[model samples]
Target: MKIHEICFSPTGGTKRVSSMLSRALTDETVEVDLTAREVDFGQVELSPEEVALIAVPSYSGRVPTVAAARLAAMHGNGARAVLLCVYGNRAYEDTLVELRDKASGAGFKVIAAVAAVAEHSIARQYAAGRPDAEDEAMLRSFAARIRRKIDDGGLDEPVIPGNRPYRKAAGAGIVPKATRACVKCGLCAAKCPVGAIDAKEPARVDKKRCISCMRCVAVCPHHARRVNRLLLALVGRMLKKACSQRKACELYL
Candidate 1:
């Protein structure tokens, strides 16, 4: 069986988690970057024998809208799917359920689900260095179980967590901006998943379209992209209680 790792990871946390799980899950694999702008997301086809590992980071307890759109547009053609939701130490409230629904709607047979923690995208102090050694072990174990189930021709539907009407998407108002250090290289605009940045003027951000996923900041060569420091600090402080304790990776098969 082949594996397709489809993910929308802006700051590398989700990509890291997906890659590790994909590695442990199957040998033959290809990555379908959800961030790519040129590809016709709906046209990517997968055979029934293929397994799609669909993952996205939780943005305020919901699927990132743009990512969800791309995923919903894809045609999975009865391929089995493993859904994953990665979050800051806070919570992955409705991300898994939303993803499962989208994958199933796109024609994949939903088989398993996972909720994993990684360093907070914005609130870095929480769950820092995670999907660390401990997470890796648990993910590998989950993969072993998944492999056995597949090997045994088990096609049971896995139950995932979340609500019907998902919580309103929050934490997206504060868009990052380029600093004086920005040399207008245009890389940020080129890499923006939603094409929210000004292509001709890289430093100017289109806030209406920006999802505050921090992809520009993560890819900026000059370290010039950032959001309001005070806002960031305030958010970090607010999350202190929910994120103070380390959360474990959860797998539902």
Candidate 2:
């Protein structure tokens, strides 16, 4: 069966985890990049015979608004969906449940769910080097189990965890700024998912438009874009205990 791999991974961790699962499930697949601004997600339609691997990073314990909106616009057409929520080893909180709701609203039949750990997007120290070798093996195992269920035609929705009213989304307070080392390449501006960075003046950021997803920082060739040092340090300290222990990936079938 054809697989539609829909993912919104700002710093690459979420995509890394999803890739392992998707590769194990099927060799033939189509990728839907939820981060691309040019793609009209409303035009993305899937047949009932197809399977959708919808993956997204947990931002402040919830799915990113842009990703959710884009996903909701798609026409799932009763496709079976396997939802995956990647987090920074802290906690996915309501990410998986929220994702499942969105996918179901788009007409996808929820079949399985996964909660996986990845390196923290902002504070790199947390869950560093994750979706690592261990994560890959575990994710592939999850895929194998999911594949079996699908092949057997058992399509009941798993008991996804989370509250009906998802946790309120936090604002974009950790906007990345370009340093003096910036060379005006405008790569960050072009790659920004929300067009927050000004293309003409690369250093100028429209904070209101930015979602603090860190796409600009991750894509900058010069590595000049950075969040405020004091703020980052504070956040690191806040997440230290929660992210210290190595969290195992979870599967719900």
Candidate 3:
């Protein structure tokens, strides 16, 4: 069966996890990048026969605004979807339930859900280098179970955890800035999901537009993009307690 791998990964962690699951599910796959600013998401339609592995990272215990908007615009057309929410060793909180609502609203049938952990976007130390070897094995195992359920043809939506009125989305306030080492290569500008960085200047960033996804920091060739040291440290300390424990990948079918 053909599968659509729809993802809104900013720093590549969510994409990495979803890609593994999709590849395990089927060889025939199509990629739908929710981060692509040029694409009109409303025009992207899916058939009922197809399966979609829709994945996104949990930002501030919620779905990123841009990802949610892009996803809501897609025409699911009653397509079956397996929702995946990747977190940074912290809680996903309302992310999965919110995704379920969005997918259902867009006409997708939710069959299964998975919550997994990846390296923290801002605090590199937490869940560092994850969707690691063990994560891959478990995710592939989950894929097998989901495939069996799909083949059986009797599917019931799993109970996704979260509240109807989701918690307020708190900002990280960790906008990345180009350091003196920046060479104006424009790579960061081109890769920014929100178009927050200026292409010509490369150093100037629109704080209002920036979602603090850290795409620019991750993509900069010169490794010049960085958040404020004091702020990063403060955030790191705040996250340390919740992120220090290793969280296991979970599957709900």
Highest-TM-score candidate: 2
Off by over 4 Å in 3: none
Q: Which of candidates 1 and 3 is the stronger one according to lDDT?
A: 3
| Residue-level lDDT tens digits of model 3 in 131-170 | 8999999999999999999888746999999998999998
lDDT of each: 0.90, 0.92, 0.92
Per residue, candidate 1 scores C-alpha lDDT tens digits across 13-46 of 9999998899998888899999998889979888
TM-score of 1: 0.98
lDDT (Cα) of model 1: 0.90
Clashes of each: 0, 0, 0
Stretches of candidate 2 exceeding 4 Å from the true structure: none
Query: Where's the lowest-lDDT run of ten residues in candidate 2?
Result: 188-197
* Model 1: residue 114 alpha-carbon error in angstroms: 0.7
Candidate 3, residue 126: CA error in Å? 0.5
- In candidate 3, list every pair of residues with a backbone clash: none
